[model samples]
Target: MTSAPDMTGRTLLQVIPKLKGGGAERTTLEVGAAFVRAGGTSLVVSSGGGMVEELEQGGSEHIAMPVESKNPLLLAQNARDLADLVKERGVNIIHARSRAPAWSAFFAARRTGTPFVTTYHGTYGAKTAIKRRYNSVMVRGDAVIANSAFTAQHVRKQYEGLPYFDGSRMVTIPRGADLERFDPASVGEERIRPFSLRFGEGFKVVMPGRFTGWKGQGVLIEAARLFREERPDVPLRVLMAGRMDEKPDYVDGLRRRIAEAGLQGVVELMPATDDVPALLAASDVVVSASTDPEAFGRVAIEASAMGKPVIATAHGGSLETVLDGETGYLVPPGDAEALAKALGKLHALGAEGRRAMGERGTQHAGQKFTIEAMTTSTLLVYERLLGQKG
Candidate 1:
């Protein structure tokens, strides 16, 4: 097979904490693959994870490093190593996806006289001066790319006195969902049957978030309990599909709660999988029950793009994505009663009403949330940066 085009003439290095499965990681992979597709070189430096294989398959180079460490000594080492890579590879630019790596990439790009770009994916709760300082690298890039309009506002509000953000170096290129992977047409009815099988032909209500308490999996379980109590004949099932990441005890607790509430037969817990499009397609109503503000509810966007109605908590990007009572419903965060009420209304929506809502969701997704739109807007920002560099 032909290798990814040599990027020697136009090399870019992407620095992140690790090649993990998050929005920033996914975006990094996408940009790297896109760069390779466009006959440019893309190199990623990180403490490698599952995405390493995908990066190599996509014809990009991977350099394993302890880039995620917060210790000052490790960061200094990263800076030196990154600068060496930048100089040796003739990297034209350095894009950092997290703060720790941004700290190293920033200085490396500077030492090599290469452009430095950063994406402010979300806000991290700062508890101390050092914490704030650690977060500053995210804004210090030559061009700071904010992933959402809300994040752009936060960046400005936080760095009010910073000069670059005076509308010149700051640009908002919203994150996007992979429509090709998430499209309803891509998943057939037969493939969707297993998800329904778990619920025994019930109206499948699914909450697709990591199995953490903050993700409100417990609240969703409670909501399912309420739904079953009220409508025993509706044949309802709640599927919690996500990796019990960083919190196995919480997952166990959810199981205990499920049993305590006598929902063992009504609720199913599934691990994270790549079959999100199929899950969304099979779902009667998709839920995003993050008790906290999600930087952005990608699941909501993907579900909407697939013409599925979503019920997300009314916080963070969900407010911007879900049109309350129009495309989908939004309830108060962490309120299972309100969640149950919203799901009740969604279930009450017959085939025609649900179809109409799904249509509206798809229209919104097509207009605002596709990968092409996101990529095109980002390219505009890059062109502006390159032009200014020239």
Candidate 2:
């Protein structure tokens, strides 16, 4: 493992649209905490949300700004404000985690002669030249960080012909799960009791992510119907747990589908919860049935860290995170029948076999995706960019 560098007396600034519950927001907090741990001054700029208090608790300072606005004048003004902040705070490096804020941060860094870094957290849509140009700011960093190898490949392919684009600058740093929190041993019956009451007696299958069509909640519902038909004697329950406010129509559609399939009692849609580790611990099997590719599958890693078998779509980052038939199973993306088959295989494993799979998954997660490894790698990138040593 690489040692973290001496970041004492240096200041690092991270910019994101908001302090939300997305992967990028979580990474921002993790990196900020890492910076403070190394004795460096850590600062974050965002529109502000639920995570502000948590970020501050990690010994990082937060500046509230309207970085989420896409208005051209607002963005340009933000750039000027950021440049002032950079100079005033003696910020050594500026890191951007979202597209809108990246544009502003890129200009600010150039204006202040500070090293700039960016983490491409998504496979951004580039349907037109204008869209591609807008997305280009994410790759303009001195060191471009990608959440996964799959994301790095997407970046290279998307900007293949740009004369100034250097693919070699892109680095893959897989997102990590908090092993201390997600450990099965840490989540006891007391924590799992509430969910167990709701789940009742049966094998619990959990699909957790924000409610969206691409998340494949409908696909999972169809698969649940199939699973019930094939094994009438076996008891099973499916929970679609996530926030539904973003797409109320989609949530309504899912409810209709669940009712049409006669899975009203068997399948339930629940709101997102803060206690994800406990939920996964209570689950018999966790699923990530996305119709589209994920930049990196954090849910899969989190579930694996909790020592639970995950059934994820066989595309995107899941291909990199999950070891098929070992830690968990990977079914064809969007294939309801294939998902049903995979669920059946896990059900047949029974308690002992499933427990063994979970153990392997836990070990794999510790070796490859712990938060310590991720923070160390990311700090190394900052150290290299600034020509600093431990």
Candidate 3:
């Protein structure tokens, strides 16, 4: 990252609904620490979660509040509270990472005359006018940062005719993989050994994400079943790891499918893990089978960075990150047959061929999707807005 911009007395207060294990939450902490390292006071406003301690340890203060509430009354109340906090703590800029919190942060910035910034983290579905208006808060920021080029384009298309919408204010900044943790050189056998034993020497493939309907964990299970049918001679093991508690019914559905398809031992639904990079390192290949488009699929790039061949759905951010026939293969969204076919193709490549593809993917992620690059780009946006305010 270029020279840390001089942010000596400035303060960056990032507001989000929760301090949790998601892309937005992770980015919130990463950017806060970068702000601190650049000689600024960094504060986060959220309902505390497991990551709060980590945030504090990195020199960012965490303020517990009800910013996650979507109730109209609570939004106004949160805005008042945030405005007061901004004045009390001398918060230079308020960056919101979610819709509900963005509403509060927007008014707080207005009330306190502090620069308001936002990151568009999801492709919010807006089937009605009310929903569209509700989603509009993100674009209202003095600067709106989209996590991927696909997201930037979507935002521009969706919000172009809005009265105050200025496309220039939006920028594309991809979510980054934490290289320090994901570095292959740093991950020793001790870390990989446990997972290695559990999944065994079979061609281990892992899909790590929240076990939601749209995440397509079921699709992956189906693909695994089909792959076993097609390549019965080959040993196939699939690990679908995520927070199954959030969607018990869906998880049950996946479990039933795995059992009925006779993929009980071949496919396993493990709990969410903190050490995803190690899981990627332990596996022969990684998979991103999201039926819906990912705003920015961090897992695909993270797997690539770990020298594992990735097979991701050929849509959204995956298109930009995964180079078909090079870094990884991209299959049609929700097409189990195509996904299974891609897996077979990877197996055909043999060990050395897969390694070469993974090497290219590592280079691709190292050059483009990196933690330092993401943090540095974000700091630039903050400093630019601060410069404007002066």
Candidate 4:
């Protein structure tokens, strides 16, 4: 919590669309909390969600506002509102996390003469010119922070015309998980036992992501069917754990497929929960079968940190997080047969091999994905930005 060298009393204003229970929102909370702990005032402005309580718990200030509005009139009003908030709070820097809020925060910071910083959380699909312009705010940060090297590459690719986006200025600060929360010791074995019981005494494959099609739920289901066909005695169960963030109809379709495939006993759908660590703890193999690449697979890193082998699609952050053949395996995206083959290889590994894989993964995660490392790199960004502003 101590101030990084050269950062003492500057106030930072973090602007996010909302404090949702996701990686981007969690990062905002952690960075703001770190700032506060470092003897600097940190204030967050967002529409607000479940993590608002966590922000407060960390002794940071939060203001509720509809920062996600894209309507021109609403955006103008948001700019004024943000300007007032910045001035009133004596904010020295404005850190925007999403495009919607970045628009308002950009102008507000400009009006207030405050430094504007942004994080490229993912590749925002921009099919239209207008959308592309909106998405450009992420790269427009006086200091842009990318969650992964993949994200940084995407940013550079997206802004190829803008020659000013020096790769050095666009920092890659990997997301960090609370090691204590994700540690095997922190989660209760008793709590995880029921989950194991639910899957029966067999190999458990867990995919924790929203129920959206892009998350590759269908791919996972197909893999499960293939696995079952090859080894009926494997007792393989696929745990689909994530909230239905969008497209409820898709979720319905997924359930119907499970039923039609006669996978009632083999597939279970669970809602999002705070006990993600425990769920990961209980899972024998964690799979991130995202069809579309993720910016940074926080779940993959967390599972690895907990000494759990992960089988993720060989794309996006998964490529960085999972040490294929050692920590886990990575099959081609949407390749159900390949995924099935990887699963079979993992299943074939006896307890000792699995344990060794898990140990290597844990060691890698601890070395590369520590909270301290993330915090330090982030603080360095802040220090450099403040220096430029000063």
Candidate 5:
């Protein structure tokens, strides 16, 4: 949206837990590439995953490390090792994404006397003193980036009256969707065909996220059953697709819920896929049903970007992203009846009304949220810190 501050001859190191398919990981890659494009040397340190190739392709170097480990011993060791790296690489500014890596980066930057920046990527639970202390590393930087305004508020409130509270340092930059990848026109028929063949001709709804309890996968299951009861004629099929590797017990519990609710035919737990855009393309309405308020819900934004009408719970960033009765509907969080009603409303709108809503969403997402826009805003944060260093 604005001219990116030049990164000429600067070396920026971004530390994250992993290069996985999450908003934090995506933002790390986006900013890393932007830094490189603006003439900076970009280095990403993480437990490498599927996105490593793409990061390399963007002219950034991948330094594989166990930064994702939450073990205290490894964290201390990582700090010492990273401190050495900062000195050897002559790192201009080091930024961190997750808490564990932020702790490592914090000590590393302090040890090397390097400028440290951190992004508050999630609204982590801090019910106890120890957990609050553990989460504090994210705010221990010269500059702290909050992925959304909602998150910025959380940071201010969480650390308020505490020693590290500095409201001035917190910056709100909303996460952006990659418009080019999410473009409906760019999505080919072949990409949507397989999904269509597999899950054909129902009111296809896809909730793309992990099988986490808070993500509201179980909520969606209940909503699906209710919708099926309300409208027996309409085949309501939902695909809860995301990283299904962790939390086997939670997964099993959800499977039981689906079975008990008789949502076996209505809902499917699809495994994570790299082609999220293709999955979005195949669905009619995208759902983001986080039982708790998300700091910023990228699902709603990305779904809107793909010219798809969305149905997300009403709270947090979804309030900002989804315009009620315009781009999509926002039912109350954890309210299965409300969610079911919203689902029925979208289907009742028919193809043309849904398409119109989707078209408006595409325009909204393109204007308000795109990777270029997010990248530029984040680079400015780096530039501001680098300029201070100068």
Candidate 6:
């Protein structure tokens, strides 16, 4: 790994669409805090959202802008504005997290001769040439950061022969959890009590992600039904927790499926919570049923960090993060039958056996996926890029 340079007194600017509760936004904040700790000025440019205050409190300045605009004219204007900011702030590096803002940031960095960096946080759709071109901005960074080895491979295969593509420039830096916060010992019974009461005293299965089709809420619901049908005597409940408002129709469809399956009480759709670690502490098992590939599965890592067993699809970043049958289980994507069988295996483990699995997961997560490790790797990328420029 490249070493982190002395970033003291340097200015680093990160651009994202909004300071919301997504992995990208969280990573931006984590890196920004690291920048502050290294005695650098950290600035984040976003439309501003729930995490803005948190960003500011962590010694990072928030610059509100229309960087989210997809309008061509607005994007061009944003480029000019960002160029101005780059020059004025003497920004040493411009790191972009989202595609729309990355386009603007790319141009601004080029105009000012500032080092440009981008994190490919998602597996963006590029069925069309125009869409591919738009998505390519993420890889245009002087140093393109891939959140996982899976994501890095995806980028390489997707844009293999492009003139701008450079395999050596792609860096894999996985997303991480705050181990201190996610530690089971740190989360008290008080934090887990309310969720435990709501979920009731049974084997609790949790799938934490936004309410989207790709998240496989429907699959989990079906799996719950199948599991119940196979073992009618087994006490179990499935909790689907995430921001359901983004996709009301999807949520409605899921609720309808749950009702049709006679799983009204067995499957619950709850809003996304601020206390994911607490919920993980309360859960017997954590699930990531993403039908689509995740660039990096943060939920799986978080569950592992919390000393909870995870059951995720055997694809995407989950393949990289999960140790099949060791830390957790992995079934085929969207296979409710396979998922139910996996769940059965976990249930057969009993409390003590499952606790042993969780302990192994916790140890693995602490070594591989801590926020400190992620931030340090990121800073090394920044330092290397800036050092080359200097």
Write candidate 5's Cα lDDT for 25-87 as tens digits: 888888988899999999999999989999999888999889999999999999998998898
Tell me the tens digit of each residue's lDDT in model 6 across 1-390. Answer: 333456897999999999878999999999999899888999999999999999988999999999998999999999999999999989999999999999999999999999999999988989999899989998888999999999999999899999988778899988988888888889999999988987897889998999999999999999999999999998888899999889899999999999999998899999999999998888899999999998898999999988888999999999988999899999999999999999999999998988999999988888788888899898998888888988
Ranking by lDDT: 2, 6, 3, 5, 4, 1
Flag clash pairs in model 6. Answer: 242-272
Compute the lDDT of residue 113 as modeled in candidate 3. 97
* Model 6: lDDT of residue 289: 94
TM-score: model 6 vs. ground truth: 0.98
TM values, all candidates:
0.93, 0.98, 0.98, 0.96, 0.97, 0.98
lDDT of 4 by residue, 172-263 (tens): 88989879888998777787877778677778889888888888999989998888998988778888988865678888899999998789
Query: What is the Cα-based lDDT of residue 344 in candidate 5?
Result: 93
CA lDDT, every model vs. true structure? 0.81, 0.93, 0.91, 0.86, 0.89, 0.91
In the predicted model 4, the residue pairs found to clash are none
Candidate 2 residue-pair clash tally: 0
TM-score (C-alpha) between model 1 and the true structure: 0.93
Candidate 2 is scored at a TM of: 0.98
Q: In model 4, where do residues sit more than 4 Å from their true spots?
A: 1-3, 163-168
Q: Worst lDDT window (10 residues) for model 6?
A: 1-10
lDDT tens readout by residue for model 1, 217-261: 888888988888888888777888887767888888989999999
